[model samples]
Target: MTSSGIARPAGGAARAVTRTLSDDPLGGTVRRTVLPSGLRVLTEAIPAMRSVSFGIWVAVGSRDETGPQAGAAHFLEHLLFKGTNKRGALEISSEIEAVGGETNAFTTKEYTCYYARVLDEDLPLAIDVMCDLVADSVLAAPDVETERGVILEEIAMHDDEPGDEVHDLFARAVYGDHPLGRLISGTEETVTPMTRRQIQSFYRRRYTAPQIVIAAAGNLDHAAVVKLVRQALRGTPLDTDPAAPAPHRSATPAVRTRPAATVVEPKETEQAHVILGCPGIDRLDERRFALGVLNNVLGGGMSSRLFQEIREQRGLAYSVYSYASQYADSGLFAVYAGCAPGKVDEVLDLTRAELARVAATGITEAELARGKGMSKGSFVLGLEDTGSRMSRLAKGELLYGNLMPVDELLARVDAVTLDDVNALAADLLGRPMSLAVVGPFDESAFAAR
Candidate 1:
């Protein structure tokens, strides 16, 4: 039941089996052990480093929620820190900070993670605190109500920032009423009416052992981590067969949907923010490496086509970039820009022209080399922190079902040829565009253009 390429021994006592994922000199050794409880534990040993990052990842998020449970996943993230059976909210923060450590959690569209980083010597404390919070949170009625207002204010704060709000508007324009289109922090309408019982029910249903992974990196031993985790989760009854790893795909396959459209939100702002994009490839698509290369050259940085053309050449925008978001079944490729309200049309036109040009002729050889170099540099630099390593292991296990070596990932990026980028550009960029704009103008402002 383990992922492909990992060997699992047959018929053993309720224990963990370990396997090495990577032994790179630069990144250290990554090992994975699937606990009998179906909770996969992954760790990377970097003896040279003094800090360790521990994370508990759940494979459920806002997209897994029903309409009535819109913000339950994010809401529970807040409640988990309020108090566990043995520790109060203030105690939780004090314990971590007492050791000069940091603890936090974030909920995304597809998953949620609670993590802590501390000196390697204090790894045991970090693991115990995080596991206690995850396993034994007391979702008190008062705490739930207090957090509800906090979440509502978070929503209002996000609303005030049009630059940030426009991306949600873009997702709505592209995905329509689908779960992917909804905000991670459910709207005021959804959160205001949510009850404690509903939030607790959502937590019990989604926070099961089979859907969780524990990841650690930096100055650690595989066996020691497994022992600590086993002791930490000793009393909790895990609903899993002791003999097998959890099934990889538990939930039904996500429905893929894409609709080309435009959504404009009129607001009084100093500048107009717009996103021009279209549907893109999913996480498992083999062509993603090519897409990454294309994205880098197109709008990934200051030297990218969008940035150079819009900001450096034309001075139409102060900030402009392109990014791609990939999920289990669907994805999005977008170019975003913030400009003077009067320059919206020109910005859109120029952005469209760049897209068309790249789609038709593809990028130059110089662009291809530069894109690969940038991708490689960023990839390596990003993993220098223990937190990034822990994140990479958790995501690889939960999403890809295997941990790909750092060199292997770079090879995939390097293998992307000019033809690959060109072909991807011709296909992905040639699709119809969905535009989202947030400014003080009506739809009529863009109708004639």
Candidate 2:
């Protein structure tokens, strides 16, 4: 829906290449137009394939939920499919399936998206159906009552999984009371109180045309897609503009209390699930590429420090990995491991030791080069899928404000020197780490280093 503020493009070499200026033709080829009512349209043509994927991204999520309205965005996503003016849930499913296509939707902290993939000839129908779901979901009384229980059960299910609990724990320690840490599904107390009127008010106030972004990929023509979007969203009342989000302030470092007083089950699960992390870079940070390379060396793949030490050498756990999940303004760099109940201490010690080792000594050239190769390879591999390509485009729109070509991304990875990776590790993972362990382990094990 807007320009993807992607960096300059690069050459066709599989290895990362530095660029003088971007060689991207897609920058010029991408077209943007706005309707009288405030709907923004963005289009690009991918001539290599015969299929088309039309996406509608709305800028409201659980983070946008006001007091007592948590999980409203996710609940609203389910209700959208239950019924609309033109079709009921069953009919909608049958219609899309008859044409050998598929439809789905997802909810996140910043957006809700409904997308469909179909043959190019069915692009108009796909657009119509998606727009209807967004602008016209019938939050019927019975459906609301029905979905409340479903969401409640979903919340309960997450509570039973140690990995899931530790994730929430890490978010709580990092974000404190900020909306960024709020659970998407919400608690029973908050979601049970939601009413049909509340859902309607939120939908009307936030789902405006100006805040909606439609991204399509595949063999669709640019002009035809522009026409289809313009026609489908013509009559909806685009009467409101979203209020600007609050400025983000980094959360003060906190040592969280364990789940001792709160009710929790799964105390006897065989493997312990640990989510140890620290606050890292934001999505818009220029050094995000360096952080990516750092993560790869630490625990990103099979050869990573955490994996090789915890799993391969000691045989303490079946799975161990490190990752970074960056959002609009901040991010989390974490190490997750599933270990034998008796070996939780060993796994935790190894993880912390590896983090400290990297911070103190930094990485060698071989480690940096290998990490760069892995990061660049993963980037290229992700581009092969149509859904991933569409997702990458949407991420660029929402984050950097432009779609970064694969070539440019590779170059950035290539440019990350050993010094860059070491600096990032020292900046992010070198401090006292926030710990979240979910299992039959004692909190004393996490007493600060």
Candidate 3:
């Protein structure tokens, strides 16, 4: 689809093919090009703005690790910034900061992203610095040792926060020994004993061209961005052969039956954080739109059922919400509440009752309309910034292998009817739940109740 002087080309080996994915009057034109190196570069051009968000997405994460390799993906994320072949860590940070920009990276269950935001004029610098970090990190022994302590401290920091710790505990309770259950930052037990050799091996094996996508948005030209990327990635041994890109490695851990179980972590805290959830659909499930609407109506906002019932009407908790976490093949649907330690049982009962109510009777037409509107507004308002748009493009390519325009995505959300929500709720929320609680109590405290 050609618009605004950008021509679309058919896919080929010798030449990069450009295609427009979307032409939203509010979000600007989205485009993508597959370079000969097997690296996919996606961009959303918004000439109305002056800043750009650029990101390098790698299709590997904690789930890709072996038992002994736990936390290696996260470790490599830190090391990449320590020093590349051309610049040291301080230079990498100062160069971006000098231009009043931000640079950072994060690791998720299924992917890792290194990203930067800079003035549009500084786009080339951003691209060069990020590509260098991805393709030419030294991963020196001394730097590895230093970052190891930093990662361990991060793990410690996470443990000290009970509210955040409970989510990881909840994942463990839900998925058991599966890699999906492990923490992205890993534990002190895992990080403290890791070796540099293990980390370097992970970087070499997982950070390949075929598994990488470079996404950028905001005031930029698609051709210019592609040229900058091509230059930045030159001399790297990226596979450019005629064969199709390498298939992503799968972490197909066996699925286990959902059991009604609870894991209590005794911490000396005034408030308890608990998560109650059941199995959910995978990332590519068609019912995800219905599930999204259901989540919003159930507890996504302050106006949601859980918030209105537990917070506004009963005053049982301070923070309460429901969420869905989707992976490549599996997912979790959960509700979290932070309340007084003494009120744990009351909160759980209320949450369970609400879930049962939704499953049995479904939602009203008013709730369905509100859910769709909220989901649509959130999706559109979120993309007003370049970072969110860049993230959208990257995820669309890495996860789904196509870019879904804003209008098309909204259409899917709008298509969900009350019947769709009821069917999904009945199927997902009716399953047995696994509970996790972090508070000043033991397992017997819950069992006695």
What's model 1's overall lDDT?
0.89
RMSD of candidates 1 onward, in order:
2.1, 7.5, 3.2
- Per-residue lDDT of model 1, residues 162-275, tens digit only: 999999999998887788899999999999999998988888888888789999999999899988988888786443556444444432465555667878999999999999
Off by over 4 Å in 2: 1-29, 239-266, 442-449
- Displacement of the residue 370 alpha carbon in candidate 1, Å: 0.5
Pick out the ten consecutive residues of candidate 3 with the lowest summed lDDT. Answer: 1-10
TM-score of each: 0.96, 0.87, 0.94
Candidate of highest TM-score: 1
Instruction: Summarize candidate 2's per-residue lDDT along 1-449 as a digit string, tens digits.
Output: 23222222365222111111222443324454444344545555567767777788777787788758888898888888888777788877777788898999999887888888888788888888887777777778998988888888888998887777777767776776677777888788888898999988888887876567677777766667777776676565542332222222223332232221212223667778877787777777788888888888889899988888888888888889988877766677889898887787778778888898898889889989889999888887876645665666555554455566666778888888888888878878775567666777566545533
Which has the greatest lDDT?
Answer: 1
Clashing pairs in 2: 3-401, 4-401, 4-402, 5-401, 5-402
Ranked candidates, highest TM-score first: 1, 3, 2
Query: Candidate 3: TM-score?
Result: 0.94
Question: What is the overall TM-score of model 1 with all chains considered together?
Answer: 0.96
Better of 1 and 2 by TM-score: 1
